[model samples]
Target: MKSPLLAIMLALSAAFPAVADVLKIKKDAPKQYVVKKGDTLWDISGIYLDEPWLWPELWQMNPQIDNPHLIYPGDALALIYDADGNPRLVINKAYRKLSPQGRITPKGTNAITTLPLEMIKPYISYEQAIDSDDIKDMPYVLGANENTKTQTLGHILYVKGDLKVHKAYAIYHEGEPYTDLETGEVLATRASYVGMARAFRTGDEQNGVPSSLRVESVKREIQQGDFLMPAMQGQLLPAYFNIHRPDNAVSGHVIASPRQVREFSTMDVVVLNLGRDQLIEPGHVLDLERQSPTVIDGPRGPRYPEDSSKFEKLLSDASQLFGDESDEENTTWTMPKEKVGELIVFKVYDKVSYALITKNQHPIRIGDIAVIH
Candidate 1:
């Protein structure tokens, strides 16, 4: 028989392998990313994943990201693997400097930042008419006088109605000067949509006079209660617009503006109402409301196109004659899947801002919901 002590030592050696081979962390463990000025999470994720819209997946693994509000320059992102061999994200805490000696401004009152993919959420513009049945619905005219231009573009049908508000409406011809990202310079000229305005009068003297409007360039009068708001034209810069209001329920205090619903072009561009003032710092993460695609059955008649008809006949023959061998699984094919677009808050203004669609796997329409992650 073998010696008792030797047998015990041999058994222990088989059980523990680390002692035989040293365990050490790799010199190049996970990659570290440094945040640069003007960099958003949308752009950051583009560097890592093939699809940037999958930024949310990072949070599912790492909990360091608390909010997606503001990601400033100098912040570091460390990615490593855990014991289970899964990718993990960790934030290296660094002391912020008050007066760094570069063009980048030192951290300010609004310099609060979050982890890799934390608190970022998207809010979509949802609509509900004040006294109407459906949205994008033209309200009927009770009466009319004349002080506004009537031009119907697509869904908006303008007619002269009673101007309900008596307060003098300030005609905002154009917005203030803003910095242009492309030129890296301040642009003095305003965008064309910001048109000029003038005030008029309407309504009775008993309850107070109602105000009306007239367009100078277009040359038309706007009667009482005419809707005045922006409509969808083409591709908007940001992916979507978010409405923020305190009193509403569908969208409570978290919305970017107080509007009921948002409009957008076929592309996933949008305009968020919340800007620099509404705590909407740059680099925020906003969640998108994913929507599934609708399916419709095709007509079951003879095909008009020769190619399609031949193909259909072939399929019919295969289904009836071959019975089981003609790839039966694909007999019913699904239409393309649609998911809402995921947007990343990139630009910020005083009362408005812009977001970019990080991922457009799904077709994001005009009125999807956006919320903070």
Candidate 2:
């Protein structure tokens, strides 16, 4: 007889026929595998299914698992079949033990993530998109110790603005402005990260005094007139999240990249025009496509005056075969857009969001179109 948990999984599998049909297993998938350090959920899922983004469906079928999103290192995953022969991936169960509270807990180290955190942690912790109005009021570096123009780690600086005593802050230099390709409207400006500092003394506006601060670290040289904002603390991001297509139809373009490169590929962080206003959020996956250039189908070579009449006669004959002479002269052909890559949105602002490229067939450009998969 099947166990109660297995029976429940089999029943759930029967209920969702469409999901079972779509969740296809790879022919060469292993019967069992162990989670290891540095292994991501996407990498693990790709080993079992063709569409790795459908990983959540596997856990949905087996509701007995505890915290399906928190799979940790050393845990064992087994590929099992239900009564109807539909494959399901489940924790070995033997690797988990009941605690004093009677809760199943996997014996392992830190939980695995959906993507490599190191690649995106800097962008999350240090950088941000801000409105143009906000930049006007932010505190800026008034002067540095020793009367220098630039300051580095361990240098003292004076800031002219509102600041609290012993508060941590991140230094930033205003970068390029993101704009809408269609309307030419400015969306948001990027606050490029410079370094970090801690306020030692608060400034008094009545006395015309500037706050005293000491630089703690530097990624770039902190110069006079650079701005400061509260430093982000702790790992506020989720350890694991599922990838899925957006529910509503959405389309946008890659407007910018933090690295400021012309072409992007897998693992590169990119900025997209779609954001909270468009209902775009973290874990939403979008497909990339490159539009083809239009080409003229008319004459390829120059015509001499001697052959002008002959060429005109030939053009007239061709126009008669195709359409009007004016129409033929203006006709241009464009090829279908080519599918390039995929990206997953991880950070969102008001009118823009940041996405990490997850896959690519060709190099993705700045103006490439992103649409719902």
Candidate 3:
């Protein structure tokens, strides 16, 4: 059997056809595009190609840019091909260098953030996983605009906790409760949708006490007792990445789904049970699997191998039919797990990673096992 690495390479070959069969470039795509501030890799790729994920296939990195992937505003990208005749996009700028105290001052921070941070901001930043013990310590809504209990967009929210003024936070309402299937332990209730608030004032040592925040926006009701967590905008990174199979085979599970739903479809995000500690990282492709079915042992009422037709075989069949329980009655039958889909890890945390369903043969749902493909 071909190793996953080999398989991935073969897939790229199959995906890349002749020069004429290369991924279609957007008709409106500029032959040369200047990297702009606020531009995401995903957005940039989409601007130039029909399928953005295939950017790596056609991205021709210019060695001089320090890191070709780190394109900055004012940097130019042009479509070109190497002597091998494969089409690619490269940064269209002359290679330049800088000394610690060089005449050319270091340009402003041009480091590219991978993902469109705004899109996943709510998931990575505001969404809080809390336990019952955490309730007291977490920042909670004390009240809203005008000392009255209600809150709305642009309304001031007074929260009781140590919150820094002018910092953004996500408001969360306690969500549906989940019980551990095995331990029967009731995990903390889900942190539900509430809204976003940016703290503009926090009580000082004497005059001011509670922190004050302005309601930026909300998905659900922005009310009292809502939880607040630091907006983790940095968690989101470049979404457009080259896909690779893990070097080692490892198995894990889909622990959660978008909106914490049990079922999900393609393009939905999935929380995985594996993370960096397990050698899992962004771009790793994992195959979704299901547990083999468990089968029950039936009564042994004189059953034997079908080939037992002759007298000699009949004797053996009789002996087998009468076999008594020796872990025999408890023996289980099962089939290999079904591969339902394929997912690529997009973001990885400490104990969990987020993966996006890239391909599915069946509806991808929770609890399906995921192993490095």
Candidate 4:
């Protein structure tokens, strides 16, 4: 038989097992947390770090916390003091919400917008796909000036082409790719925008041929599985047709190719192959590069002494008599120089976008590479 004191001691020893696992973690409790429903473990981490990018770091330390994506209600986030007494994120159940903020509150949020699809399709340049037999059989068309823009591409414009009746084709604006500095990634290019064609041959000769075409509806609000087919050749700016992407993408492939301002007409739009999908947001800055003319010495030879020959004497006479630097400057400045233009990405999309040439510092043209900053 055990003594009364021994019995009491044994009972306390049995209870110690439960008490030890209870975890006195008052020092390891999180200081603050905003209540939100359907918030994941990654989402909470983003809020604490003030950087959504640090979610991966928290996952690295906690292995028992499986499924980094799930975080249920009443989840506790504790801050533990390390050996150096530095506070860090250490999970503990003791850290609970005193009063849960329920749903039906617009406490913290913003108006949300979904990403736009790539409205434009890709075009296979002659260099890409060659129809060997049809060498001169280029896709071309002529249309009456139904331009919406009094000067620029506005509301709607239609071109007539030599397309077969009831034949479906695609229109594409071959654009350039952009880069993302945050991820060091290359974004895809936007190609042709497709629209159904209700082809009709009026047999009306506008410029000596019976090639007249009417393009019906145009492509917009793009999705996957969209492609481009041959359409009547006509000049068009793809920008006027669709809403620009919300953000300007700063990421693009490194482009050093020299481009010139081909279309000098005012209100001319230069199209690019970057959009919302590239992480291009509005108000992004793009730099344009201009190619300087190469200086070439034309007919350089030893000039006779100033007083010896008429040519030398004439030169000396002109320099002393005129005293104008105009001739000397004109000789160097006369070379043809290629100029480039830059603009801010005011509009964006998943794959296609448009920009405005800011301040008209330099004239922008087709084929000019817009490097995002």
Candidate 5:
């Protein structure tokens, strides 16, 4: 019979694997390192770990320090092992010395972000996905005060809808609709942000009076019939969060590319078919795979032969090879999908979510598959 302490240890080992497989520290990882300006958590983790997304597991939080997760510039990190020989990273508080005034100050005021803010700042602040049913009820531009076809910054525009006084709104234009390829369902429509506007006077719907709004900024010329949505206020971006694989087996396809490019690479924002309904949340890392095309094995004729008769004969032979299954089971076979890259989910909607490509070994296409890493 096993003792109670031994049974508990067995249970823990079965539940949570060792740091060697989960954390997997790199062979060339430094014993001690200093934090620097413009350094992100992902980049720092890559310096010490083979899988940077597993940084949260390798970090050992010190309860004595305030906000231990917030690592600032000049702070030193030391890689140490516990009694069980499990690797962990901890902050070296003794790295800095007291100043002449007997006070210790950090080199930088701001804490390092989880990912580069410059890459996803615009998408988080300006870009939005709206449902198709809600678009018709949204406030739209009626006209401009200057009687021009298009409006710019400092131009007053008239909007017809329920508007609150002293409220800021983002001007947007309708873009392409995102659809689920498997389910044949329209998830959401992409909103093209054009400018920012502030409402000074409220509109009276009973009197048919339009509200007055002043355009404060413009990325593009604000045209008539542009939609209006509430501007994000005091929205905090994700700075420090636990990175982990999806709890369940979640898989989806890349539905839309915001950059309007055929192929996308690292740092490019792409929309996935999975969302909150599918239990997808921010900070979840996913692996990307590109499906291989099916190849047909048949008798080869000529390379780009101009003779029409030769081409016909080749086509007939290919069809006969495909139809005849007496000797072989099938003439065509699909190759295995190749793993291309990885992406991290940052923003999620109801049926669709926005993810930034973090690692790209190959150019990701529109229909690439994203599965839990």
Candidate 6:
């Protein structure tokens, strides 16, 4: 049987706006261009506009000319003015289907993806962000396989938790803690996946029985002290993401990623603090906003005259800065959050979610805020 993920990827569609508007064209942009194989909309839009994420604002998708399935190697994109003199990408009426065109086949026969889906595939599928409350109380590994430093697939492991029946669990190691930017409180600890394990037997402390686990799969070396969180038996992130903007407002923070990197960019996988409980779902587009510091100082005033005392002073020198905490008027200045990029949530758990950085106006970093686009 064919894999369902492939089927979903084959049928993925692009989302567009209903109305058109005047586009803010970049100076010295090309008047016309031809779409080629492996050319992405991101790359093409960068060639025409200052903000690549604004492509939908000016791209007039002529359903008559373009095949919704894919942008092939020979499609021509021309810059033209509409009747009202608004600048728009001229949408052709026909895709130049040849005389040999025949019966339409299933989506995957030879169709290309609407966007460069390959870049974020593995991240969108395998990566997940977990909250502390979701996994801390779950089963955890004590040690097994002779308490060896390294453990591989198909090895026996021991876990310490209450298991009523035989089942499967995801093995992982905890990463750094993600703190709430607003309250400065610890929100959750990120989970770095290690492997997958199946419960073979339950260890009974009263009866002196040891819990036994069989490692089904290993993403990394399974070692002692790793965590085992309950997960669906055969679930995986699906390969379908319909480009869209959420109707509701979503506000969250960047919690984690595969690595402990502090910053992220295009195609990077990030875990947002929002999740299933917040009504988040796959294909929900959000904006990554960079929060500016609140302590910008004003221009310096004339400095006080230096003390002329020749004898060494015991007291420390103080600048007596103008913007002091006690002074309310000139103490602080803040700027509005800037939209740095667009993110697409791929997976959602109880209190956390996994997302991919699709479009970036600026480099995004940890603690950046995510709001519905």
| lDDT of predicted model 2 | 0.75
Residue 297 shift from truth in candidate 2, angstroms:
3.5
Model 6 segments more than 4 A misplaced: 1-17, 20-118, 121-126, 161-169, 198-208, 229-235, 255-257, 276-279, 291-333
Candidate 2 lDDT at 141 equals 92
CA lDDT for candidate 1? 0.38
Residues 1-373 of candidate 2: C-alpha lDDT, one tens digit per residue: 0121222233333433355374688999999887777777667877987666765567655755643336666667788887777777887766445223222334443566777788888778767888888888889998888678789999998998978888898899988898988889889988878898999988886799999999999999998889888887322565544456788899999998989998998989999999999999887878999887644444653333344455555664565567775445533444688878888888888999989898899999989999974
Query: What ranges in model 1 sit over 4 Å off?
Result: 1-30, 49-69, 80-103, 108-159, 162-200, 204-210, 214-226, 229-357, 360-373
Error of 4 at 99 (Å): 3.7
lDDT, candidate 1, 1-373, per-residue tens: 0101112222222333323222333344448766665454445556665544333344333455543334446656666666656554455554224324322435543232221222222222212112122212432222234333433211122223344342222111222333333343332212223222333445453554443444433223332334433333211233222212112122101122222234432223355544555677444555566334322222453332342445554664565567646635324323442345555554454544555445554555444555553
Model 4 residue 114 lDDT?
Answer: 13
TM-score of each: 0.36, 0.80, 0.57, 0.26, 0.81, 0.65
**What lDDT score goes with residue 281 in model 4?**
56
Our tally of clashes for model 1 stands at 45
lDDT by residue (tens digit), candidate 4, 1-373: 0101112222223323322222233343347553344443223433554322222333333434443322334344555444544334434534433434322234222111111112111221210111222212333323323522221222222333354655544444333444343453444443444453444443433665443334455554222222234554422323211112223335332121112245533223344556666676553445554445433221353333431445444544565457645235211222343435444454455654555443244555454555643
Q: Compare the candidates by lDDT and give the number of the best one.
A: 2
Q: Against the true structure, whose TM-score is highest?
A: 5
- What is each predicted model's overall lDDT from 0 to 1? 0.38, 0.75, 0.62, 0.37, 0.74, 0.62
Better of 1 and 4 by TM-score: 1
lDDT, residue 66, model 3: 32
Q: Candidate 3, residues 1-373: lDDT per residue as tens digits?
A: 0001112223443444434555677778877766556666555766876555456566433343333324555555677766766666765544223222221322445444445555555565545445666666788888876766667788888878878878898787876544443344544445665778898877653554788899999786676788787765333445345456677989887777647688867667777767777898777778898865544333443323342235434444444566534334333344579888877787675456777775677888778988964
Task: Name the candidate, 2 or 3, with the larger lDDT value.
Answer: 2
Q: Write the per-residue lDDT of candidate 6 for residues 45-82, one digit (tens) a residue.
A: 66887655456555444333333334434555567776
* Winner by lDDT between candidate 5 and candidate 2: 2
Off by over 4 Å in 2: 1-22, 63-69, 93-109, 233-235, 298-325, 328-331
